[model samples]
Target: MVTLELKGLHRVRSKGRVYWYAWRGGPRVLGEPGTPEFVASYNQAIDSVTTPDNSRFRSLVALYKASPDYKKLAHSTRRNWGPWLDRIADHFGELRIAQFDRPERIRPIIRQWRAKYAEKPRTADYGMQVLSRVLSYAVDPLGKIASNPCEGIKQIYNHSDNDRSEIIWTDGDIAHLKKTCSVEIAHAIDLAAHTGLRAGDLLRLSWSHVGEDAIVIPTGKSGRRREAIIPLYQELRDVLARIPKRSPVILTHSKKGPWAPGSLTKAFDTAKEEAWSKGDNLHFHDLRGTAATKFYLAGLTAREIAEIMAWEENTVERIIRRYVGRGAAIKEKIRRLNEVRSRT
Candidate 1:
């Protein structure tokens, strides 16, 4: 007889033969002790009982982080997801997965979160989205939860009928920012307006990416290998030429080597207040839309603009239509009518 020390292994005699079983997970029949089959069955029973415990939300998040899907996310995305995940874990980490099996329980939590962040509906919605994905992962592969509780939860930031919060920067606004802000802030704004790169991408840009005639982006927001090339516009060239390359990065603060996102934002907020008396509801990202409008007005096709901006052609077209299409179309129509009248 082979002695096994595995817990939950019980023996029963049936038909004058020995049978071994693992408790809770049911029977694993090995004919007799000291045989190869018996050893294999014993090992299998041990494996069944030693599965990792992921019965809590916190453990499920740890498993999700280890999953290929999470690992494959862009670095920026993973960085952004950390705080959202931390928030969710802080609030509900100790709760059993079964506690959130119903949508009713999830709805009230979302409502409270929404109310807490009532001023920033977009943030609330994004946090909710992160929580929803975590719950979904728990339900499917982890099988800890019976269902996702976040299903059918309405987003508080859905402003379908209202105008978008992001407004484009005008020529006057640009000029005003350049005049009032520091040289570094002015250059950052000009670069954004000319390049249409996101704040993160702009900050990550290195001197190596800049060439005589163009800027090369090896990796962008998509986290793919696609390279984006933007030609060096004359005005942008002037701005770049004036700044001495202090670090490997093209942009940096005088003291701080590279601008942190929060510091950059706060600096922009102060600059905006000094530049505009009315405090225009413009974000640094709005400079991207401003650049897209400028590109469209300069007669670049949506496909060409898409390549330059590292966006889909459809996205380029939609942004153009939203920002400059109506005005550009009306101006062209009036000019054509005037020419026809003059010829007649």
Candidate 2:
């Protein structure tokens, strides 16, 4: 006989003939295992719309919560999927693992979401992918569900035929921005352009990460500790020299703590306003793209760029194609032109 108790929720025990259940809300049942009566009653109680305290489901939930991987997963997942998770949770009204274990229920939810996102089909599809992943945790050894129902659902993404252009800072744009922005923001921008660190990584950058002619980030996005050597160019060093030791952040603002989210955008907006130019549609991320482009143009292979950027070689290619499109793409275009010239 096995007994299960969820703190502040409910209790259940297996006896010789049947399973006994008790809960705070209001429910009691006893039925022999493998009987229709037992399964029906269990399912009904677990599916309660108001304050459900089903012990069977809680067992699985507890295991997932207790996992050592949970904290690291939460941090990384929130960083990437926080916005989407909030939206899904709002629509589902705090769904439990058992509720989402069936393919029929998941299919309807996905269809409903697709209808809701008819205008932006791509984002709607991405929401479904996020939900699928959350539900997949139920299949772990300690979980209640035997399998993930979301395994078979096909995804549809809406992408445009034309590639999105990246904002490339020309020498003149760099000069103007450097002169216009405060020394702190200007240095941050320079570092961003040269190092290709993501905006989040750049905000977390500290003197501790800097070493002899190198920047070593022990925890990169790919879950690897990668060290990239930065040439101690006079221009980069000059930018680094202007920081105020009083500020903990590399990019000093009046407020305490690191650069605020969208800090670069605010500075860019000011620079655009001052220069009487429509600001580049590029984000702070475009700086990473710009750096990768320069690296590629310098005849570095994708593998070499991956090492510097702490990305997989394929990821390096994707970034180059999406952001720079300056290497083989340019050569291919020129080749097509030459072919036309020969034909003429």
Candidate 3:
């Protein structure tokens, strides 16, 4: 493609390739200048920036986007909220904010919109969360409403409330999975069970993160505020030694690269379906509780494990109380009885 001069048309050369933009720091424009496509691109860019407000809701949304509060958000947060924000805009952009001035009216409307995503509880919950936040912004700094209708609405997703008895991925479970699942899935389970890292964080893990004494990396969750310093426990180290250094990431799929989010879920689900259409089960996240159990059995205190896993101290305590002591409790009673008999 050849370049031509046009007002506000920015030309950028990257990696020996030419790219055109409607303006500096603007959307990419395809086709050559003076062509119909280029002209349409420029018009679209201008229209996007100057689009008229459909309603006060949309106007407040625009204001929220430009606010310092939004600017201060973490990159991961903005990325997660991006789609939900767009969905909210598409669905409610034209609705008058003043029309539903009371909680009774707004709450029902919010629930109705949220119900559409009920099949995916987490996704639906996130959409409601983003929508609520935008409306909350309207109530506070914008003062467009007297109260936030989003407050006190219960979230539908509740993974935290899952029963702990059947949650841990034990040694037997791991061995069984290894026999049937792909190599990457096996390693992923091992990594999660040992380190208690979330799936996204573990997929992004590389050999470089393996420090001289520990695997040192910032967690993807916690807004990346917390660092996970997993010690090179012999078991974890052994798991690492088994994998060939085909790529920087310790776990990789068929292509020998990091797994994309969608691909990781697909691969995990396929592995599960191969092993577990007929019996009791484990999800990838259950490995976090498994790791916590290992840490407890290995003598780490609840507070210490909590810090390492980025969980609340009480949450760690709850998991340990539920999963770590039942058999041991009975065994200790037997030992006490045997000691009394020997003494007598």
Among the numbered candidates, top TM-score falls to 3
Candidates ranked by TM-score, best first? 3, 1, 2
Question: What's the TM for model 3?
Answer: 0.65
Clashes of 2: 0
RMSD to true structure for each model, in Å: 7.7, 9.1, 11.1
Q: Tell me the whole-model lDDT of each prediction, alpha carbons only.
A: 0.76, 0.63, 0.79
What is the TM-score (0 to 1) of candidate 2? 0.63
By descending lDDT, how would the candidates be arranged?
3, 1, 2
The regions of model 1 sitting more than 4 angstroms off are 1-60, 74-76, 86-120, 135-152, 160-166, 223-226, 254-261, 313-344
Clashing pairs in 1: none
Q: Considering summed lDDT, which 10 consecutive residues are worst modelled in model 3? A: 323-332
How accurate locally is residue 77 in candidate 3, as Cα lDDT from 0 to 100? 87
lDDT (Cα) of model 2: 0.63
